[model samples]
Target: MTTPSAEPRPRFAADAMLGRLARWLRTLGFDTAYDPAVHDPELVALAAAEGRVLLTRDRHLVAHLRPERAGLITDDAPLDQLRQVVAACALAPPPALFSRCPVCNAQLRPATEDEAATLVPAASRALPGPVSRCPGCARVYWEGSHTRRMRQALSRALPGWIS
Candidate 1:
């Protein structure tokens, strides 16, 4: 297996059962496609088209056509499911945390301070950090207490994987 620094992070497509895991993966800056309402066959086809490893908890999804890039998520809990994917995919440590939109799986872009300041409250504008905006969802983001909480969770989910 390749070491964390050597391997490129794998793109992923999670089945409906692994939606939360997919969000976490996106939060970790990985390209993760997730839709809780998509049908199984369409999900499989999407994964194939995107060249992503399809993470699923369904036995039938795995058995269907024996998809080469498919992986079965054995754990029911979210973090444990993440652990499985990290090990099975030989994932590299994420290069950028909080770089993708967890809700939409879109890469975030830097927002001008002036532009962001107009959106948040006067007190929030005083906080020091770059602001980001999701193109797909038009949601704003910044490093704050939520970042700390997520970092803590990732520390537990994959020890030594994040700072």
Candidate 2:
């Protein structure tokens, strides 16, 4: 008999205080929305409209919305928060989520330094060979200290991940 296929990764919308978490989710290639000013009710509606899971720290908001596609944000730190979601969702860690743009929630695209010369800071551009850009927000990103930190955290949180 054939084994069942793994479920698709779940999408998410994060509340105000969970901005960092939302960004982390995006960094992990999850379609995560981070609207700091969005109210609980609006978040609920948007999550429903988009068929995304609501990620929030507010217990009342979760109870009020009660969306089947919802998950609670337990930890305060961004990495910890991601770990919680990953564990709760029973997702494969590491490469399962990586190299996504957090700001606009877009996948990162490869571009040569020459190609991105006009779009990135001189300091940033000078540091690397090629860079990645967010098609949705036009933000640029590359492997750096932040990536190391996040990788370390992912390691700590998901030791079982085959990486």
TM for every model, in the order presented, reads 0.91, 0.80
| Top candidate when judged by TM-score against the true structure | 1
Candidate 1 residue 98 Cα shift, in angstroms, is 0.8
Residues 50-102, candidate 1: write the lDDT tens digits: 77888889998788656658888889899899888889877878888989999
How far off is residue 25 in model 2, in Å? 1.3
lDDT of 2 by residue, 1-163 (tens): 0111354767788889898888777766788888888888888899889877788888888787686577878788887887788777765554644567777777778866575777666666566445787777777776566766876776676686624
* Pairs clashing within candidate 1: none
> Model-by-model lDDT, in order?
0.84, 0.73
Model 1 lowest lDDT segment of ten: 1-10
Residue 137 in candidate 1 has what lDDT? 95
125: Cα error in model 2, Å = 5.8
lDDT of 1: 0.84
Deviation in angstroms for 30 in model 2?
A: 0.9
